[model samples]
Target chain A: MIELHNVSKVYNSGGAPVVALRNVNLTIAEGEFVALMGPSGSGKSTLLTIIGGMNSPTAGRVIVDGIDVYSLSPERQADFRYEYVGFVFQQLQLLPYLTALENVLLALAIAPTPRTEKIARAYEILAQVGLKGKEHRLPSQLSGGEQGRVAVARALVNRAPILLADEPTGNLDRATGMQVLELLRDLNGAGQTVVMVTHDPQAAACARRVVHILDGQIVGDTVPAPEHALAPAVLPISQPAIEPCSNATERVQ
Target chain B: MVLLVVGLAIGVATAVALMAITEAMQADVAVKMDEYGANILVVPKANDLALSYGGITVGSAAYDVATLSMPDVERIGTIKNAANISVVAPKLLGAVPLMGRPVLLAGVRFADELRLKRWWRVEQGMEPSEAADALAGARLAQSLAIQPGDEVEVNGRRFRVVGVLAENGSQDDDILFVDLSAAQLALDKPDAVSLVEVAALCTACPVEEMVEQISHVLPQARVTALRQAVTLRMETVGQLGRFAVAVSAVVIAIGALVVLTTMLGAVAERRQEIGLFRALGFRQRHVGRIILTEAALVSAAGGALGYLAGMGAAVTLAPRVANVTARVPWDPVLAAAAVGCALVVGVLASLYPAAQAARVDPTVALRSS
Candidate 1:
């Protein structure tokens, strides 16, 4: 569980300070699928960043898993993020020199896992993200959708419970975005707490609860269908094949 | 290790070649002056004309043999510094042809002068005691390709070589030693000499003034001291050393440039790698150490190789050639110092690159695609 009590985040570029999060307060309990829905400037990304411990709130306190996440030192914040949160960025930031599996394995360098056991864990995670046989390939050799899948594998490589995705499909087409969305939805359904921020409603629909914001304030919190979602999409093809019902409104998420 | 070796090769060869050539020139000139270590020489003024301008006219005349009678030799021997002096007033020198090469023939009162000028070391046979025979320096025998039993035609006279002096590469190595009467009669000049040398105490003061004043006192004669030649040789050697140092400096500059370029590019290429390391919990100093280590490795190799190659050049290539001697000066120290300095310089060169690598923002860096 994570909470931000009336948090406000501001940044100073040269002289003037710019406010990103303003008097915002929110909470998500354990194993919850929360989607932050807002316009481009609605501070949704700011809220997610604050909750992720990437940026500290200017005013309010942040509590996560029964600990004052911000009260911990900056170094401790990084350690906590590394241990507790998995991040899937708008751009799939895979290192160029590393293979797909090694990109995931990079997180293991800081893990308490034995060196001999890390490769097995990396391959397992890669398999879990529908990247079973593609571990040896470089990011450049993979498709956009596949690269995003690898990034997901990397984020979860350390087995971090709280997954934070900032526009998971911002770089993908509708078909690929659906595949990725279904993947995240499956992880949320499997008792994984996931906070995804997106401007697209369909993506937000995959979440059990959607928190909508306008400007920098939370305007509405809505409940959607099937509050419990799919389970971390185990390589999709394993599920029984279904007909392609293209109603176009099955909700892209 | 590879870089250190290459760099050492470059550095040692550069420093050694420079050092050996200069030392060789110095040694060559010094040995000659030492052989002429009679300390002082008094020659008749008119014979001085023949000595200075002797090569131009083969039979030019000035000083009469009658002027340098044994009485004058005795009179000059009475100086306070002359107590140990055995005057070496050889007959006039003349060129003889042997195997088509010119060789200077010397006629000396070797039996007496051997006491005053005893520097010559006999390497072969024995000194010429019988008349109509001669002693030759080892180099002179090599030039004529002659042995002790060999006979050489000199000024239309045949003279046999009874002995040869060891090689010192001095003026003594280029001339033949014979009896004064035999030399004077062979060249048809009687009781005269090209020059005279007087050995005296190696004491301090007035060597220049004594030679000048003493020669001034002697009628129609010129006196030259050995110190003047030594001074000239010493000054020449000093200049040559400075020239060697200048050349060594150029080599060091080139080495520095090579190292700088290599390290700079390596730093740039490794920037992302550095950031990767920093995010993995490595401190800035750790990043700095890696870079410095690379540089030290490169420079140490260069230094070691340079020293070995330099000494090799000196020892192998120097003596066999002209004006070069194998003088490996402080080789071990220079090699170690160059390598150590290369390490320090490598650390310094890494400073800027390390700083840049350290300043990389993990947040912004993770932002890139």
Candidate 2:
């Protein structure tokens, strides 16, 4: 569950005020998969960051899971992010030096879990994201879609309740993008909450609920019928099948 | 990392080599100074009185002269700093009539005298070993036209000249030396001594302290330290020590600057990586620890290698640079201190860079690709 009440963000760019968001009120129930759709500079990415607790609004408050997100100290806010939110940064921001498995493990680096258990959990998440055999490959060695899956695994590895993704399939081909979107739909079906930001209609169609924004304000919210949603793409015969992330919510938590 | 290590190594190496070479030179100069002559002189106490007529001061005369006895020379070794006394050469001086002219006669113990004045070289014949044998100074031998086998009569006593001393450009070239007992008998002043020349081994020996101790033992005698030689030796050693300290300070400062600049560059280059870590929920202290730990490791390695290289350089260069013959030995304590100081410097130098890294905004991760 997430709630934003009349949130607004302003950036001071060389003595001039630039408004990124204005009077935004939004809510999403638990386990909901929501997509934010907008044109470039429409403030969708900014809204995603604000909801993930990575950015503070210039005015108004953000409440997530019943607690005011910005009321805590900076250090405690980091703790809150660790406990409640996971971010899949745009462009699949995987550290180049680390392997796919290691990149996933970074999410749990500060966790209190035992080192062996953390490693096991990272491996399990990588497998569910269809990267079991490619765990040891560096990001440079993996395909664009595989790298995106590694980013998804990293976000889900810590079992945080909220997943905030920015352009998860932005760099993937049509078939590869369909696979990644289907993975998100499957994760949502199992009760994991996902909020993604995208400008692509085809990518946004994969979500159960779509919120359209323009000029820093939400203009439309809709639930596409199951039949109207983009159907899963037919895979080429040579393409590898991705493992379905069934029961991910229970396993991840 | 390699640059940091090399910078730290250079500083430590210069410090160690300077210390080793300075120590060797000090010891070398101390030994050479010890061989030069006696540093302390003990003489019979005397009072100077002006010899004047009614209103005109004609000259000065030494009154109440207390002659030092052989017992007083023996008691000079009883001081608290006696261990520093390398040689004690007692002498008796008097004027005796010889061949229609008055000549200065110095009675001395040849063994102790030779040890005290190491620079003395016998130009002809052997050292006088017999009670009836005597040595002549270069000028005295020239004036008397005496040979090594000639006989010299002094105070109606006949003595054989067994050796002729080389010209030393000192007052020693104008005196005749003989056995102390023989001169005591011929001068008819048995058990009398005029002065004592003490060669105190002054490597770490405190010359002033030895002088004070000797003065305490022979209260009736005037104990004087030849401060010219001691002060020169001390000043030379002190200058070397100060030079070492100054150079070490500069080298350490440059080394710290090297570390600081290199770490700052690393933080600047790793901005996106640091932002990523911050976004991953790593605390500020965690980021700082990562940078500091890297610095500590590199500096520790540099310190150890620097110590080895420094000692090797000292051993190879000391003889040519400082003219020292002693081999430089490895010092474990200095090694530990070098490594410890390098670690401390490295950590301190990296602090600002580490803080900069910790302050990196996590939002940069969202902005940067």
Candidate 3:
């Protein structure tokens, strides 16, 4: 379980303090697929980074698996990040120089595992993500959707319980984005807790629950109907795309 | 990396070459100074008498009443510092009537004189080795119109000229040289020597101390030390050593500056890569180790190549510049020291740049694409 208590983040912009997150409190349980929906500059990505222990909240305590993430020393915090969380950065941030297999192996670079075992685990993860035959290809050689799968494989290779993804499909077309959304849904279905930030309602519908934020404040929390949930087949012609929320006062309940 | 290696190699090469050249030059100068002749002069003690007329002194006359003889010159060899003596040539001087004119005559042992005056060249025939043989100076032979193998009468004794010496720009160019016993007999002063020239090996031994030792053994003679010659040789060698050290220091500083500037630029370009490593849970020390290892490898290569190039250049240049016959040998101690110095410089120069790489923020991964 992941819990955030009154987490607030402030940035100094040319000597003036700007607040990115304001008194945000949330909780995510094991095996949950949660989507954070917000427009640009809405602090949705900030919340995800804070949860992953990559960003320090101005005032708050983040507890993951009964351990306070911020209370550890910097070195211990790095170890905690390695053992507990895996991050899929925005735009799928695959290192261009590394091959698909090598990119996946980066997650275990500091792991105490032997070299042979690390290679075997990296190979297994790449094959699981549908990149078995293209493990030696560079990112430039792979398609946009294939690169997204590489990022997902890098995150899942560590086998951490919590996966934090920020705008995973922001750079892909609708059809390719749907493929990545399906991959995330499958990973979450395999008992992995996922916290993803996105603005598209179609992407949000793939998650079981959605949290909406505007201006650094959470406005609503909702669970969609069963018919609105993503299915393996193409979307039905009768079910139209849901509109994005406009204000903090709007709620699905 | 290539630029760093080349810069460091050039610095090491210059230092090594300068040191080799300086040593060769000092050795060459010592040889030349040794050939210039004796640094100590021994002469008979003078007796002075004042000549006056009607209370007005015409002049003062000085003569050697007690002349230095063969026994006094032999006693000079038994001194405490006798081992430092390299050559001792005794000469008997007199004036003899020859061809209706009084000519200066100097009698010396040819073997001892030849060894002390290594720069002398015989222009015609060979040196005088027999008691009745004589060697004529360039000016004296020309003025008398004497040729080699010609018989000349000195003090009613006939002697054959066997050789004529080349012009040496010294007092030897105007005198006739003969065997010491023959000159002593012709001048009616047997076993008398006017002066002695002593060549002392002074590289490690002091000339003044040797002069004092010789004086104690030959009390009837005056011993003098040539201070100007010794001072000149020492000062020349000292100046060359100081010059080599100064140039080497400047080159090493330039090499270090090149490494620091190039490494700083490399660190700036690799910021995103370093951030990725940090995000992968690598410690700051690991990042620093990577950078330092690269510098050390490059410096080691530079040091080895520099040593070879420097030694080759020293062997070729020493002969032409320093005028030394002996070639400079490859020194193993110098080779090791060169490589060690280069490694130390490279690591110290890269320290700041490595620290900057270690300080890269891991949050850069989230910000940059």
Candidate 4:
């Protein structure tokens, strides 16, 4: 579970201060698959960053799993993020020097597990991500959809209860985006709390709940439409024509 | 620039340490041998085994003398390496009578001593060609209260002290030079002599090789090579220079590895790009640690090149040491290069920062700015 109370974050840009988030109160229960939606500078990603302990809030407090994030020391906050929070980004971040299996194992380097068993568990998670035969493949060899799957797998590998993703499907076309949304749902169904941000309503529609953010504040949150369950298909990024059928309305500038 | 400065400083220090002591040992031999021109010795023939320091031994014995008669000097002068010879007049070196104790007196030949004039370094005395003048070693003359025109009684024969031998040190310090006939008569031995001296050229041969050559030429006399006394000291200093070269090579290798590691650090700390790797699940470090592994290989190559350059500097500067000839001493350079290539650079370049990259949190890394 995660909660934020009256949170305000300002970035000291050394010129005029940029207010990233302000007066935010939010609560995410256990096993919730929630989507956060906003245009650029609406603080969707900033909110997620603060909740995941990546950036500190300039005012107010954040609580993850009942532990006050700011109350803990900086190192302990990092430790808390490591043990409890798993993050994904619009750009999948992987170690180019490590193979698929070894990439997953890296999430476990600081985890409390013996090394031999850590390696074996990494293989198991890759198989769970439907990459059984691609465990040793380099990331460069994988397609965009496969890369997103790898990111999802890495986020789920440490078995953190809360998964935070920023712009998870922004770079993907609708097909691949839908496929990635299904994977997030699959993890959510398995009792993981996934907080994902996207501009697409169709992508957000896949979530059980949708939170819309604008002007550094939460505008509205509602239960998503049930019809959005379209088939959990293996969406291909090669077919980006599917984007318009999803969230074609969102635009900034 | 820092490495070259430090390495050259160490090299100069090593050269000074090695050259100073080796020169001193050689100079000591020259000073001691100048007192007696016995470059080779021959005594009532012993075994073919070489003597320890110098001179002939009758059945493992040692004797000291200053001059010999003409026949013995003539016989010994025919030796191969023996370029010149002198009839050393045996000065029965006994103490002169004084207030507290008798002083050491050495009887030398004032006449016919100029035959080996090249060997003597005169400080304050008439040359050996003077017959009526007897020169005491300067220090010996001071100790004995005797100088030129000073009268001294030896064996109840009153003689004027006419000459004092230059202070070349060792035997000359306490010895007196006079006529050969006068010394032999005062010592009570008309025909028997204490020893003879033969001065020889270097011949560019080691002492052991020259010993047999000298023995062949003087079957009944003893031969001593003064150069061998410093030969072992030179070998010791050569070994020390080799060790210094090895240490410098290792230090240079460490510097190269440090630079390689710093570059690797720049690569590891760029989290945004590495996040792309994590999302792709490339796991590059697991694929035999290729990027980091290349760092070590590059550093190893640098170390080899640096070692070559350092050795070039050592060779160029070896002759700069006073009296030290330029000898490459190939064994040390080869060993130091091997260490620079295999041991120093290979292990240190990739280990630490690569481990840091390995521990980067892929999940948080993707979200990092």
Which candidate should be chosen as best, given DockQ against the real structure?
Answer: 2
Per-residue lDDT of model 2, residues B305-327, tens digit only: 88888888888999998888766
Better of 2 and 4 by DockQ: 2
Output DockQ, candidate 3.
0.30
lDDT by residue (B138-168, candidate 4, tens digit) is 7878777776777666665555666665666
By the lDDT metric, which is better: model 1 or model 4?
1
lDDT tens readout by residue for model 2, A45-70? 88998898878899988999998998
Provide the TM-score for each candidate, comma-separated.
Answer: 0.56, 0.79, 0.72, 0.53
Q: Which run of 10 residues does model 1 chain A get worst, by summed lDDT?
A: A228-237
Q: lDDT of all predictions, in order shown? A: 0.68, 0.82, 0.80, 0.59
Compare candidates 1 and 2 on TM-score and give the better one. 2
Best by lDDT: 2
Q: What is the lDDT of residue B354 in candidate 4?
A: 61
Give one digit per residue, the lDDT tens place, for model 1 in A42-104: 888878777877667889988898888889865676677777878787766678889998988
Chain B TM-score for the candidates in order: 0.54, 0.82, 0.85, 0.46
Docking class of 3: acceptable
State the DockQ of every prediction.
Answer: 0.08, 0.43, 0.30, 0.07
DockQ of candidate 2 compared with the true complex: 0.43
CAPRI quality of model 2: acceptable
Candidate whose TM-score is highest = 2
Candidate 4 segments exceeding 4 Å error: A226-253, B1-269, B273-369
Per-residue error at A58 for model 3, in Å?
3.2
Model 1 CA deviation exceeding 4 Å by range: A225-253, B1-158, B161-361, B365-369
- Stretches of candidate 2 off by over 4 Å are A99-102, A127-149, A170-186, A222-253, B15-36, B47-65, B94-115, B118-168, B173-192, B201-209, B302-319, B322-337
Q: Roughly what TM-score does model 1 have, to 2 decimal places?
A: 0.56
